[model samples]
Target: MKIAVLKESGGEPRVAAIPETVKKFVGLGASVVIEAGAGQGAAISDADFEAAGASLASRADALTGADFILGINGPEPASLAGARSGTRLVAALDPFRRRSDIEAYSAAGLEALAMEWMPRITRAQSMDILSSQSNLAGYKAVVDGASLYGRAFPMMMTAAGTVSPARVFVMGVGVAGLQAIATAKRLGAQVSATDVRSATKEQIQSLGAKPIFVENAAGIEGEGQGGYAGETSEEYRRAQAELVSGHLAKQDIVVTTALIPGKPAPRLISDQQIASMRPGSVIVDLAASAGGNVEGTVDGQTVERHGVKIVGASNLAATLASDASALFARNLFNFLSAYWDKEQGGPVLPDEDEIVKAIRVTHGGRIVSERLAA
Candidate 1:
């Protein structure tokens, strides 16, 4: 089987297949082709890939006759224009919001697998791109917030006076949120967190951070499939807002990472909440790309309002290109390895496989995901 790794476009600074992964694909008896300059964003040169036994080719050359194509993001429309039927494409395509891209891929007679849909089962953990990327984003969010804050994170003592540690409030308890809490605590900040899932209270406490509970979540099921948080009712939103309002006033740094799959980020902070915060406080909104969790946040920009700095950093993982690309490329490699058929010397798409069923978005010139079809 011929596997092609294309250079990422759309200003994305990460490559799908790194040199280390190219070596693995070649070990599987597959001919690996990488587009020229594909790994530039990750600080990898074409020479590196060539040394790993991958031939460098132009974008058109790489896609023209390849059996499978890999990318970090969705391929450009023009690149997919000449793809042949039965070609398999894999990427961390955000199909929930980019359904049109999936339709376009299907129309182009290409089979597409979205890495975001990888099941959260133990066996599939290595292939979980969301968790891998989110972990970096969470750590970066804390680092970025600390840089923007005028005061120090850890307490200090001097002949002049004693300085208290900054107070940090994390508004989600997922992989990213938990990382944020741990990072903040390690930086000597007083960290506290809240979540829609009641079970996260123990997780927060285990990290030496206090858990702020939303009292109204008692009868609500906030845990969704694949270990994601589900959407809450209007009543629950009101109670959550009431609980968070009091805590906002005292926080020096607030990092919001709440998200519901296939839905806009639930707004946790309003203008009034921002207005109530003390001057010089910082808020990092990780969900800003899919509609912000904080009101008045603009994706990819930081804005100050009512004396508080609100950072809406989109794609925080991309900021750490080398490490993020390595992790993401490993995820793709693991998924490919799991589905590889040794005797056939290629990937096997078994429809009955739970992991395949969860991630296979399109096949045989049609949208195949039951969730997307619905």
Candidate 2:
């Protein structure tokens, strides 16, 4: 099989698979083809792919002749212009939101797999793209928060004086929120966090951070569901804002990492609360792409409030594409291995297998995901 790496479109700095990974495919009797200059930003060189046994080819040629094609994001609506039929395809694909694109791939006779659809089962752990990418996004979120804080992370004693560590407040104790707490602690910052899930408080405390109590509110509606955060009621939101706003006056940095799957992230910071912050405090909103947790966060830009900086950072994972792609490629390998039937020399059909049932979006030239097709 000829597997091609098309140059990533849609501002994706990541290549679907690295040359080292291509070498693995080459060893499996697959011819690896890469579009020239595809790995520039990742510091991957054409020479590296050549050394790893991949053939250099043009994007047009790769699309026309390859049996399999890879991409980081889903197919670009605009760039699908020249993609041909009969090619096996893979990506996150945002299959939950792009029914038309899923149908388009089916219409083109391309078998589609969405990494986002990987089941949260134990066997599918290695194939969990969201976890891998979210792990990185969590790590980077703290880095952004620490950068914006004008004070030192760790407490230090110097000849001049003793500098106390900055206090870091992390909202939402999910994958990203936990990582933020850990990262802030690593940097010697005092970290505290809050979440609607009462079970996560011990986890937060285990990370050497305080867990702010949220139980005093009369009714919190639903805090989360399906391993994802849920939208809290407006009354709960107001209470949360009031409780968290008080912390900002003494905090040096605040990182909000709450997000609901398939929904805009919940707003965790209000203008009044933000303005209450001491000058030079920083709030890094990791949920900026989907609305934001902090009021006044402009997507892809930084704004200051009362000398405090609120950062709306989108796609923090893209900033670490090299590591991100490696982990993502490994996830794909695990998924493909789970679904691949060597007896047939191709992916299974009827799509009844668990992994198949979990990932197949457009099969037999039609939209198949009940989650999206509905």
Best candidate per TM-score, number? Answer: 1
- Which parts of model 1 are misplaced by more than 4 Å? 216-222
Q: Please provide TM-scores, in order, for all candidate models, with all chains considered together.
A: 0.97, 0.91
lDDT of 1 by residue, 288-329 (tens): 999999999999999999999999979999999999999999
Cand. 1 Cα-lDDT: 0.91
- Give lDDT: candidate 1, residue 358: 94
Model 2, 173-217: lDDT tens per residue? 877888889999999988899887767888899999998856667
Using lDDT as the measure, the top candidate is: 1
